[model samples]
Target: MKPKLLTLSLVSAITPITLLAEDVTTLPTITVEGERLPEPGISREKPEDMVGTPADAGDFLRDIPGVSGTRMGGHGIDPIIRGQSQTQLNILLDGAYVHGGCPNRMDPPTAYSPVETYDSVTVIKGSQTVIYGGGGSGGTVLFERKTPRLTEDKFIRGQVGGGYTTNSGTKELFGDVTAGSTQGFARGIIEYRDADNYEDGSGNETRSAHTSQTGNLILGYTPNDKTRLELGLEANRTEDVLYSGAGMDSPQADNDTIRLKYENQWGTKADVYYSDVEHVMDNYSLRSLTAPMKMRVPSKSKTQGGRISHNLLMDNEMEWTMGFDYQHNNRDANRFAGPPNMPTPTMLQSIMWPDVDLTQIGMFGEMQMPVRDIHILKMGLRYDRVTSEANRAGQAAMGGVTPNRLYQQYYGKNADVVDENNIGGFI
Candidate 1:
């Protein structure tokens, strides 16, 4: 009886093995189900297909509903979403911040971004979440890059393309390359565009000649299949950006960015980034300095921020996500002046930006639960603390009155700083 029991146990174990070994056509099937978030008023675009459109960043927004742009020339058009533009709308490049340099809105944040280099552009209308930085009253545009998984086989991938437009003699050249093994990967991208002035329908030449170039490099490491760490560097330059409707042309605009990110299958993610932008726009560089209203304004902006977020899965039926984010920005400006009557130029150096500083900190959380087979419940809450201040109280040399005096006359005294606390939620 003992021998028979041992034989029966061995046969049972070996029977399944023999069945699996003989199986050649039968295999297990896998089905994956997905659900969309309940958030509304969100729009997304894939910019790679937009290469056929104009080379400017504003060109991509033309197809999106409820979005428009202010055309100053043939290039560097500022985007307006639902009648909101400039600082009113938050523009982020890979979760980083950059400020425009032109006071007349000549060089918007979009101008600094290379549309071809990004994979996704997400637009959220109105105040949505505090996971990102604050002051997104009008909306938010997030430019994102997705990293590909490393394969077991070592290989390289790349794309090269170019295009030309006859209307303005515009030319664009772009290339993307990636090389990797199962453990690590590296990628690089470059996009360059140059265009001459384009003629209106009436055959009149417009002041829109421009040249721009951007480069980005990323290095990533994967210790396991479920975790990834990455570092990214980017540099962008735009030269000869002409604005016909505005008073000055941007001779040189330079931007630098650095980013670090980490993610794991445990639903934890983090990002740290910094960006710096310097802009030099003068009438003399692109137009005549001897003109009656010759002016030059050079400005620099520095921004740094970071965010850490986690996803908590509860009982396989619900998900909760919470995060904290903070951002700081500093801006300084100095203006140079000259005219046909003056032999020497005088600088209104201290007054352009007045050394502005903006700081914001926020905490946010969201929860999603499956109420039934076909229904879901979603809720979110966020709180933000924002502060804005200016160091200089005086006005430019060209102005007859000071900014502090004007503010005091209108609002009252001791209005030098603004502090605000906001709490928002949705269900």
Candidate 2:
């Protein structure tokens, strides 16, 4: 076995790729009469590409069958892949979980990370392979960050663009730069966007217009021909919107992440890898709601994890990949339930430690065999030990006689026990 180790998100064993325009859908070049327009507006000057992130990622998924999304406010609608959301499916950032903010179908996972960060996004429509890890009963979406490789020129290049809508008449921008030599290189990207309240197709104004900002950076180094090392950072934030039910609208947001990854190959035939990621999300109260509703709901979360894997080439037409991965997700959120018109200007506070921790340890292996030059077979299997827990933080009643706080909320009154379990299955 030559050293050729590999890595990926515990949920989406991602490999390097060149994002090609090949899918299950295709039309004959000859056509019915002559070589003409290919399916309407798709021009040869501009190759067809998938659209992900910014909520409109589903447009890229059109090649897949039975997928749709309900209109939220702006950006695009949330992805509705074969009638499933969140739990039924698994969403990965650079291949890991970014866990969304809304539960009622607003703010999809792809919205957490920008699309330009990855070379490609792998969408598995079903329980495909345990080697990619489990939990994707509905399916899995891997928003990947490409493996780093510096060019010989040692130069930096980037691009920026923006667009507007008929209703909200929005403004947005995107740009990134990459530069390095054969030894090491680094890249970074930034995004800024905003929109005013938009009217429905019928001219009815919807208060859902909002604003968002995001930034990303990546660093890579190569010591030899077989192994490599890389690091990354990303930050995102969003303001308020009228719709998208999550009890309270966002006034301020702080979402930042950091990642460190290392890859080492023994020879051309063997490999080793180590990668870790940390993510954070925070929400602040809004002024409009505080004055009238006297309501406040703030929450924060942090998730960090690491993984390692090895690869083996059995022969020219057969290959095997094996590895183990571990991850943990935790959060602290505040929920408010108060007032029946008025309690004589009284104040009450209920706080629950909505914090939860999930950890998974697993070993997986994959085998691929080529039955023919054009036909091949692929399979993978794994076993995982996963556990989850939730503990009550506390609760208290506070008042200033005249009610300094119009209204306040708390969390975990249910004495929520940690939902812990061990699980394993196909990818």
Candidate 3:
């Protein structure tokens, strides 16, 4: 057995800690640019900042420069960009497409979107991007609502908002609640708006008044950091919508929508959505019988669409995307017109739209690369096949309807119930 003992010496070294403090008289100046003019025709705005700012969605779009709205009454104004509207412009709500049931431009796509509920509004000036959808000859408008990401262990959040306007005697109330944890989340929203007939500056009241109510529920599942799936449902109701241009007022409109979305870490995403709208308009609902004639129109629209896209990255400076999208919209409208204060006459019943159906399928590819330190290059290509068809024959006041006569008399000689196939591409 051997035992060893060692001696230890302790040495101390002086170390100086320099506490440097210099008297500073001036601070570095930082110049910040807050607002700049948008692109020639494109514009973007945060809906929260513009709350209680406009009368309706149409008015909201008009706030952007170069955008104008055709104001026919107190609400549901049609937005026109540069000089085009209707089919010329493409509009989307939360990436879903919706077409109005009105044929006389009384209810455009914008009519269904309660701008207050959206998070942001983006206006694409022209047919520059074929990524969203086709038929953007005039422009594209996107209203998006971003879902909240739950990153905390536990959280409960809510928002409540309300506003009023005097000109149209309008009132609005909105509320939202979201409670969730890190793995999953659930959110719900409710909104209501009502307005009375608005008078002009001259105190002449117009037949423009409306009431709307909407509710939404969304459920999100995030199993991991790289995968997510969401399901959403929404319902909307609008009553007593008076139109100055049309001969009737919308007495009732009920709309419902369902959406499902999935995304993965591989940069692949898919979205599917479906919407149905039922609308009824009649003169007697909000107006007295005029011109010794009473009219009523009932319409319906159904829409469904989906898209699948994948993003690819090559090296660090180049990127590419390819996707395919399909959308189908069908509209049916009929009118009943008769003498006032008398039994409804058979002669006045007529087919207005006669089941018009529009289908569009498109494929698109795009690439982006940095050309230089000061500039970037981007290019996209899209091909779309569109089909528009409708029943041509209708019941006339006098009698005997013919498809050839209806076609040649209104549009052209070869105008039948089915239109020619249309195929086009854009870059």
Q: Give the alpha-carbon lDDT of every model.
A: 0.80, 0.55, 0.78
Candidates in order, TM-scores: namely: 0.84, 0.71, 0.86
Higher-scoring candidate on TM-score, 2 or 3: 3
**Which candidate wins on lDDT?**
1
Q: 260-286, model 3: which lDDT tens digit per residue?
A: 888889989888999998888777757
* Candidate 3 TM-score to native: 0.86
The reply for model 3, stretches above 4 Å from the true place, is 1-41, 224-226, 342-348, 391-398, 402-404, 414-427
Query: The CA-based lDDT of model 3 is what?
Result: 0.78
Task: Please write out the lDDT profile of model 1 over residues 58-150, one tens digit for every residue.
Answer: 768766777788878766677887888888788888878777766666667788787888889888887665456656667888888876766
The best-first sequence of candidates by TM-score reads 3, 1, 2
Candidate 2 to truth, TM: 0.71
lDDT of 1 at 319: 92
Model 2 poorest 10 in a row by lDDT: 39-48
* Whole-model lDDT, model 2: 0.55
